[model samples]
Target: MKTHTLLTVQEATALINAGKVMALAGDEALLRQLPKGNWIAGTIPYFIADEGGVESRERLYASELTQVGAADVEIKTYTLDTIKNIAADGPDNGYTIVILPARSAIHTEYANHGRDYEGMFIKPIVGWIAGVHLDDLNRAAPKVVDGSAGAVLAAEAVAMHVTLSADKMAVIHILNLFRQDPDADVITFAETGFSASTCLVNGKPAVLAEYLAAKRIDLKLPLVADYNGAQINTSFQGVDPDGRTVHFYAPVFPGIEYRQAAPVGDYVAELGALADGAHGGVQFSCNCILNYLYGELQGRKTGDLYGPATFGEVAYQLLNQTLVYLDVRSVS
Candidate 1:
């Protein structure tokens, strides 16, 4: 009945040996000690567990897919070339769970172009970006393990394509606490990129970094774009040394309108309000590391919304500063 759980290496290994299919998250050292089985894991020491938000290297976070009505699953790894085929690789009537290592080439490529992959958004795709401990960011790299093949990959992505029973379907939800500030200027880019030198602010061409300086913008506030009714976020990484180019966690697309998000006061309370009634049929979930850090949620409770606090979230595409979850619903 638990959504995400904290377990010792022995506990997680035992679950796998028992033929339990799972998605695991933990420090690289801890995950490396587990035996191979029907499981896929990524490196991440942060989690929102039963007690609260906690970071640990001594245990693993496990999500048993079988416990949530996953009928059949196929685990596969993809490189940059094959990543685009992910949509075609999924179950026709089911959903997909993908994990990519942080700072890996495949991760960057997917973040920029994964949404355009043919057949995407057709089937529900949910997962998180594997990330290393903040302290080990410079020394150690993130990794994803394909338990089926006993492969530990760094430059690729591993995914679990799940097939639900005939009557069941997977539904995806995103909890975005921030909205477009109605008083803010509309911003647009001249080209699509993860980093930009120039942008149009309220229909006038302006230097990206200089423009931010003039407005005295809060770097913590992400650029929000409304895709139909869905708010997609592109988090600010930082400006270059010369303050000439601005970098973002997610790419900014040309032609799309964007605006700085409205300010948020208590992230925990606001996220809790958004999370109300969200736990009923959730099969899996993951939140952004920005939310974990910016919201100061290390010792706080976020209602029943719990999962790995990841570098990035996936809901058929890459997302930043957002919480994504998948629910299993029965259809007549």
Candidate 2:
């Protein structure tokens, strides 16, 4: 079973120094004081703890693996092309936790080459890009920890790649409440890039602003794409008036056509259903910040699911407006 705990900076430092495989979420200042050890961390003020939804800047949320869990983790740090190199060699057959700074150039680079990176690595990854509130977006930057090499501030991504032993295996998946509205007009794009502001609607290049206006769709509702079996989301952030382009929390990939997803009717029931059988053996999990606000998760519980409400979640590739979790179980 996964053990989620709340600790102060000093308490968390002790655990880190004692060699624990931990995933941390808290304020930048609190996390910065932590001692370097076997762990990875992200910045976020919102979380769904064992209790309920709450926001804190003082207490640190930590998920520490036991001795059995510790033995299964091979923590490592990657930067720039190094991530590609590790992925190229094929990481150990298990789940990889990728925690990187939000909105950094490196973040953009990885987003742009997500598919290639996914193809190179043959393991399930469940993590999120670290981020702060929109108010902090301009004043503060996202931070990540490379425990092996101490704390890294700005542009770098720290991955706590867990390679489970033969006896134990990992099951990584996502819980997306959004699905395509088949009746909605199909939206396609010709450009192959991330952070797309303009897309082609029925083969005609049009600004996203005009398209959303014409369709009368809510920007809060993300554009969904079915990637083979997995349903991925591209969430809207806002529009740039001067540029007349739409911005997204996660990049909209090329070639794959996207459609606006339908809104969730019942947040509690849907979230509960999604996490129905995931209570046990769940190792790591996180929901999108968008879900927190849109779902009105404050003071509400979703079964036994809990973790930081991140800006963007990662289930192999960067995703938006979804709940991503990892389940590791032992073979009989």
Candidate 3:
């Protein structure tokens, strides 16, 4: 049986009818046409299909979850108030996959403070933010569907908890190609948010957007923060009309030192090389939309690391311009 790929609505329904627990991604209309079954999904028209990046309102990307969902699986929804219970409510020995509409209350809440949620980072958690067609940004709404309950949600999040056998374990992996340049000016913020006006550049107070302009910093590059050895990125969205405020796809936390990422060539190749040693281990994976556009991933490949190109990536917490994946392994 296939693990993941683009499937027609009829084909997906066949899998659903077979009692295959899964994760799905597609257009809102197509997703709404799916039959009730063991699955959870979010909306998105862009995907890194086996053939490469493509956008389609007719087909869906499906990842079979029978292995992880084999032992015991549960599908549920969470409102903004109940979203905090996500990590703590998962199976004791399994992992959780979640989806939330882009810019929804639950999405904003989880992206801003999900790291501090109870039981976070204790178990592997991975998912993507749902999004509408690029042209429908203002008119259309993003949604997540609870296939088992046949419920579609716009303001809420849907999560699937998959309990594996005692001998197996689930793990989350992040592939971030961007890293802080050693000599770049260090930038710090006074508050955490998706946008900032004032920030400290090399320890001197300065307007963030003005400083970036003065330094001729390429907005295509992201701000990188090092957590121990892990390099987390906060991608640039745009500068406000005032040119003093800078917006980011992900929030920048206060008290963290950040620097512009170093330049790199060939993101598609780099992404594949980064996951070279983990080929078959990746059971599910998703890339960021910024990468698809900025890196020009259309019609390119990332080896076995593929899925939808989402608005944002999530691995325990929100991430920008990165790839998030789930891998299951036997207990050593």
Best of the candidates, lDDT: 3
Estimate the TM-score for candidate 1: 0.96
Which residue pairs clash within candidate 3? none
For each candidate in turn, the TM-score is 0.96, 0.92, 0.97
Sort by lDDT, best first. 3, 1, 2
Name the runs in model 2 displaced over 4 angstroms.
Answer: 67-72, 118-121
Higher-TM-score candidate among 1 and 2?
1
Assess each prediction's global lDDT (C-alpha) against the native: 0.88, 0.77, 0.89
lDDT of 3 by residue, 1-332 (tens): 57789999999999999888889999999999999998899999999887888889999999887465434898889998999999999989989999989988888899899999999999778999999899999999999999988999999999998898899889888889999999999999999899999999899999888888889999888999999999999999999897788889889999999999999898778877875564455667899999888878788777667799999999999999998888888898
lDDT of 1 by residue, 91-176 (tens): 88778899999878898889879889989999889999999889988999999999888889899999998888788888899889
- Superposition error at 332 for model 3 (Å): 2.2
Candidate 1, superposed: residue stretches over 4 Å from native? 1-3, 67-71
Better of 1 and 3 by lDDT: 3
Report the Cα RMSD per candidate.
1.5, 2.2, 1.3
Order of all candidates by TM-score, from best down to worst?
A: 3, 1, 2
Report backbone clashes per prediction: 0, 0, 0
lDDT of 1: 0.88
